[model samples]
Target: MSGTFSALNAATTALWAQRRALDVAGQNIANVNTEGYSRQRADMQAIGGSAVPAFYSTSDGIGGGVSVEQVTRIRDAFLEGRGHTEHANYARLSTEAGALEQVETAFREPGDQGIQSLLADVWDGWEAVTNGPDTDATRAQVLQQMEALVGGLHFASASLKAQWNQTRENLTVLVDDVNAAAASIADLNQAIQRGNQTSLPVNSLVDQRDLLVMKLADQAGASVRHGKDGMVDVIVGGVTLVGGTSATKLAVAGSLDLAGTGTSPVRVVTAVGGHTVRPDGTAAGQLAAMNGIFPSYQSDLDALAKDFADAVNGVHTTGAYDKLGNPGIDVFESADGSPINASNIRVAFDDPALIAASGLPGAANTDSSKADEIAQLRSKAGGPDATYRRLVVQLGVEAAVANRGVQIQQVITTQIDASRESVAGVNLDEEMTNMLSYQHAYAAAGRLVSTIDEMLDVLINRTGRVGL
Candidate 1:
């Protein structure tokens, strides 16, 4: 009887263990297409025989059947950490490349509609005026060309300012997103830690938390440190953005306007402490574009405008005369006499007769030397045209470098993701195979239980009623 009961007990445990394994396999199959889901495994261990010897207990060499020890999530911590780093790097380069492309579009270089071509038209107009000093049509054409050049500069400056303001606004929105994600992660941490304390299944909670953390990495190059009770701390620029169940919000502080960037600059800081976070992902890319990339180009454009006005004015105001023979004043000036820049540069007057087309005193209609000198300024080494060309070349090189960086990093990120998927991602075929194995085990255990019942029936009713 004892032997039969023991066999029945072993069969029962086997059935339960196999059932648990089948449930785990089913779970894996169910979530095969789910993102961020790690494959799970059920660990089985054979129940051992009694260790102590007792007078009432018989010595049985056979051990009890299997029991499930625990279910485990299949994840490689090292791979996950590397994944975070690579993802952050990829996001940074991608953001920078996108920003550079926008800047290039604003310049519109290497095309007929760009500032370079407009500048050439202005120079050509001056040469035309020099050739026909007394022709009112040629003088009017020069004024029109000058106006076109100023318009180009103004448009370029406005585009840059618009891009700067838009990027700043995007940074603010991104910080808000980061704060929301952090708070959600903190909430997840609390749930996960509590589940861990109670020995409850918290794999789903962990998966959610990991997804949020990866998002933070993309947004701010955040890193993670494992904490007790299955909790993780999120770090950005050496500061803890989230610890245990508490999250720290981030804020952007700096120039609201592009013109004020030189004085105020842009920075990401903790909302409470105002401590700066020098991030490296998308946020860092935006900061670079706002504080360095756009501003550098804008500054160069302004300098070109000022240099252009100064060079032409220098020639027009000295040793030159207009049709009326009055000394030539500045040909370009701001509305209120403010320092000239790309945004404020304009033609000083609209009258064609006011144009200084001659170099000799009181001989404006005869000598064309002043107009010729201003036209020749286009070929000067340190002139506006040369400066603009350099600026365009620099932008092209930087943009190319940024794009190439994105391509290279993309390859690396893909490789790492593949490696991670191999370990954590679900495999339907494998799960199906496991399901078959568990099914057979369960069937065999059921058969053993039936066999045990037959033996018990023979030992009890048949053995006692043989004579009847």
Candidate 2:
């Protein structure tokens, strides 16, 4: 009787174990299409051996039941962290390339009506003025071409500089996102640690934390470490970024000195919620944009402005009777005594007196030399129009390259994500198979229970008694 009951108990345990397995399989199937769902697996262990009568135990040992251990989500923290870093690098390169492209577009060089063409036309006008020195029409044509030359410069310079500033502003917004991501990562990290201590599955927190790390990396590159104590540590350039479950926020700070002369790199301090974080690699997309594009574009603009001023002044000083016939007055004067920026260039020539007086000869007081000065303007600075044309072409090329970079990165990121999903993602077909296997095992256990009852029924009624 005891042996029969023991068989029944063993069957019951097998049934319970299979039922649990079926439930878990059902859960996997239900969540198969869920985004960010890590595949779960159940751990099984055997219960301790059962006790039996001494005589029966001597002949055969009792079997132990199955026990459920842990159900864990399958994932690798290392791969997740690496995905984040790569995302940041991709973003950085793409952004820098984008801003540079915009800067390049400002100049439509080598075109028929570009700055180079304007210079040629202006020179042509000067030659005509040279032949007809007293024609009002010739002088007027010279003035019109001069305005065209300045107008193009104004348009190109202003457009490029504005684009540059816009990119910088975009960096500020990306930094805010970075800070918020970091904070959320830290919070999730702490929650996960606590959950681990209490023997609870940190599934939801892990998902949230991993997502944030990916986002943070996209904004700024940082590597993540999942510590044994259940805390997450983030590092950048080998410095502790988020110290063991504690978040450090990042922000965009510091004006572009455009004049910093230090090798230590004038850092843009990133502060968060009133707390400051030590800045790391400008490797992330937004920081890279700020680091590379703005400096180069601003320098180029400065160079162009200075060269424009010098070239015009050089030609004016060489020709006689080009000044407004006034003995001591110079042609151009800024309140700041510097060459005009994109903002101030148009304003610099707001007065026609400045434009009319910008001729040769300190006190010529004669329009006769205007034709001679126009002739000289071409001879002196006319050939250098190629320089401006080259600048515009470079901008267009850079923009094209940037666009290519973005496309390449998009492909790369997609491939990596697909690879990762293959390992960690749940599949409904597999889960359904597991459910069926467990369900069959459960039915087998039920059959054992039915068989045990039938044996007992036979013994109780048929074996003991027809006479009663």
lDDT tens per residue, model 1, 49-135? 887868878559687878998899999999999998999899989988888898888878888879999999999999999889988
Residue-wise lDDT of candidate 2 within 359-397, one digit each (tens)? 444542434444455445544543344445455556667
* CA displacement after TM-score superposition, residue 84 of candidate 2 (Å): 2.2
Q: Would you give me the overall lDDT of model 2?
A: 0.62
Query: Which pairs clash inside model 1?
Result: none
RMSD of candidate 2 to the true fold? 4.9
By TM-score, the best candidate is: 1
- TM-score of each model, paired residue for residue: 0.96, 0.78
Q: What is the lDDT of residue 438 in candidate 2?
A: 83
What does candidate 1 score on TM? Answer: 0.96
Local distance difference test, per candidate?
Answer: 0.91, 0.62
